[model samples]
Target: MNTAAQPPVGEKVRCLACGEVFDASISVCPVCGASGEWLALYVPETNAFRRESEEIFLIVGGGIAAVSAAEAIRERNRLCSIVLFSEEAVLPYNRPMLTKAMFDSLAEEALAIHPRSWYEEHGIYLMLSKRVVSLLPEERELVTDDGAHFHYDKCILATGASCFIPPIEGTGLAGVVAIRSVTDAAAAARRAEAGQNAVVIGGGVLGLEAAWALKKAGCHVTVLENSPRLMMRNLDAAASALLQAAVEESGVAVVYSAQTDKINGTETVESVTLRDGTVLPADLVVVSCGVRANTALAQSAGIETGRAVVVDEHMETNLRGVYACGDCAEFRGVNRAVWPVAAEMGACAGANAAGEAAVYAEHPVPFTF
Candidate 1:
């Protein structure tokens, strides 16, 4: 775990009112008897109940879902020794801030969800920059990138997604960037500079975000979409129109239904060629078209996979003692790969992975606000 990513030291845990030194799991303030916004989530299956909790291991991919799930499980099963592992070098940080970090150096402290110290204080064993390579669901064992093995009463797969790259001529050209994680953001920010002209592929949320970052970098940004409208999957035509107008107001150029044929550049991406014989000039290109579930690792381990890792509403896979969630898992064909569903799915999977019966609920759609 990165020590810099931990929570602030000596953050007082006081009741909302009366300011009592309370030490009980009461939703209402112990002294004031008022229910304030104190988020202490729990799962009874893995928890010790009247005694202690069952020790569990949580394997996370890059995203907030795993973090949310880990917190929920940690609060309830205080006795459980949680081993938090991430493939990313950084500890659990606010991943959404990656877009902002692309153009500006967002403080590391501000991005971190819990610093290394916070995990230590909470008694969680943090394995930063570690990857879980194999899952032995039958033996309840798992292997890491270094061939280290650990047995779990249960396991979770929050492997998230991979950057979707469409096959096109000259797609391999350099300066073709993808913004999926903090590492990607940092790299893009360095590659992209002010006064550069950037062409962005995809009209999804991430594409728009990348355009914003590029604009802030003083680049003239143009967005090219294969779809007829932006955010077609998430929003209706009316909402898309409003969002398009709002983004256009920000000085972003939008090209609708652009079928890209190839990238143009001898050594690096200098422009994009469309199927209609139109060329969009650029100094750099960023792709945020969409994401596909990262199920290769799971597939290698012989776990069942559908469009994604096939899991039930409870986040359980076909195999016992193994669970999947977040962007990687498909629950009853529900693939709302946003924060809310991923968080709920990951939390449910983590709690149940500790030898407890935990069922997940269907998440709601994002509100059109």
Candidate 2:
């Protein structure tokens, strides 16, 4: 069982999915349940290049990018004050596991990216459940929703992204939802009753994962894809065909070129109506549309933004002393909102924010089943 206590030091492994470090003896990640194959030997970084400074580093968001930025900042400067603000009530967690381990008892401790002791020991002040409402680049100040203001010398924005919900009727119903946070996952799991019908809109990787999770919970699952094939953006025709075959073999129904018209129900989801007039009964509906980068805060602060907050190779925005990374940032007109890219971008942003030169090189983002 995962707890708030720190893991034993020495010879540990880190979960690539959630960046949770634990004893190497553990076969599966206690936090995300990722297999041992995803574990890597954890080697603690030495502060050999430490440069003492009093500059305050403020990181906004509670995702892996925020945590990575904090770690990078600490590596180069030990005495610098690092303040992390997360809107979530719980500590930063492994977000990708929400659908992958939907049925697991994902208490705060189990989902935490690192034990609370790590932050305490590193002197990283965590302001949980605090939403930064405004950013004043000129004043180097930020205002939270509670009217509290904070000042920083340098700031990193890892505000991440939110799940995009396409316009569809009846989405406000109780059983119709999207899997984004732990709370969403828990709600979906509760609705995944055995022998009940669950309809998933979108045939992307996330939609498939959610479908499989509901199927594992004994729900009759059906996936709807507006495109002619599954994972159209990621998989070619041959690969998509192979994946569809495998998915259908697992007892989940797949419908191609299925455009949803609306969700049908009163207070709870009862069924989904397709544009072709086909109705699929659904006790629960999960929307797996793509995500949109959370760039409103950056844009409102007069930062350049196209699809997301535009940044240079160093992950620095147009404004000096300000940087953006993770899903909320775009480099060279591309923003691959993946874990590896976010981590790399955060490291570069943090390093540059700490008076060190760092460059983020563009690379092909990899996706796995």
Candidate 3:
């Protein structure tokens, strides 16, 4: 039941896990290693921060999907009131760069997809650090975490998926992390010390990229993939083997069919134990299994969801004025959870919402090892 605001710039934020208070300047709790998401933000006593919105088009989420949809809507209708809500405090950036450039010191300006001025120029109201807590499709109303209600002519549920961390023992340790957002990458970077042992669970693209980042940061990296082959969803056995060899050549050990039973450590991760009694020493563990579509808000409002929010070719949900797109939506029983697919879906949803005829066709792009 925690709200979005808390831990103001200089205030002490309390950690829900361990009740430890720390400065808001640090995104992660130094006492228990919990990320900023677990810590509450500081909110003032006044209701001045409460936003009253009646946008013509309301988009939930600030990722690429939401941005694309906003642009499409504006392209179709210039004077439409478009409001975008983002759970993160910053502007939408290239999310893929978080893994690709983890070792590099990237400025916020470099990571942003569109500068702050760009949103204003395009007439898109970007509400940062705000989460839509509930959706009332019956009333065409949306409620944010801060208790602000908004009515929209049409709404897009583009809330993206979050990193899925398996229920593994010792995962709460200080060195354990996930590389999902810029904040996550920064937390992982802070722990990737020289000569440290880093274990990356799941040999998917995100995991491999994280392992490479740690390797470049001078950490001895090992990739543990539970399946018999790495990137099993996309790569064949031969391609998987070739990719494993290349990763090994870069001084990273790739282990297949490795079931991690537990992360062995008291407070900080010391090593990882496999099901076969094999133990790999580790100072950091990055879990990059996959993502679960963010469908809680839609489901709470009685929207049908099976793995993801159900949508038609027009990207409209069961409700007349509500639409869903990106990773949070499924069409004809298929949910293509990739950047390219998300962009296409966003465009289709935006166009159709703006009274234009648009249909989302499946774009099949095979995964490359």
Model 2 quality (TM-score) = 0.92
Indicate the TM-score of model 1.
Answer: 0.82
Task: Flag clash pairs in model 1.
Answer: 5-115, 6-114, 6-115, 6-116, 7-115, 48-52
Who wins the TM-score comparison?
Answer: 2
lDDT of 3 by residue, 1-369 (tens): 977665455576655553434467657653334674678754423211222233489999988789889877877777679999999988987676788788775567667767899899999999999999998877788899999999989999999888898999888899899877889888998889999999999998889989988898899999999998878877788998898788989998888999999998888999999999999999999999889999999999999999999999999999887889988999999887776567678878988888776778785543421
* Per-model CA lDDT versus the true structure: 0.73, 0.88, 0.83
- 1-369 per-residue lDDT for model 2 (tens digits): 876555565579977775656677677876456774799989976545567799999999998889889989988998899999999889888787888888976788887878899899888899999999989987999999999989999999999999999989888899988988888889999988899999999989889999999999999999999999888887899998999899999999999999899999888889999999999999999999989999999999999999999999999999999999999999999988887678778888988898888778876654633
lDDT digits (tens) for residues 60-152 of candidate 1? 564666765666667666787677678888877656567745675645655665666877877777787899888776777778899998887
Please name the candidate that would achieve the greatest lDDT relative to the true structure: 2
Better of 2 and 3 by lDDT: 2
Candidate with more favorable, higher TM-score: 1 or 3: 3
RMSD of each: 7.7, 3.4, 13.7
What's model 1's lDDT at 352? 71
lDDT of 3 at 316: 95
- Summing lDDT over every window of 10 consecutive residues in candidate 3, give the lowest-scoring window: 44-53
Residue 146 lDDT, candidate 2, scale 0-100: 100
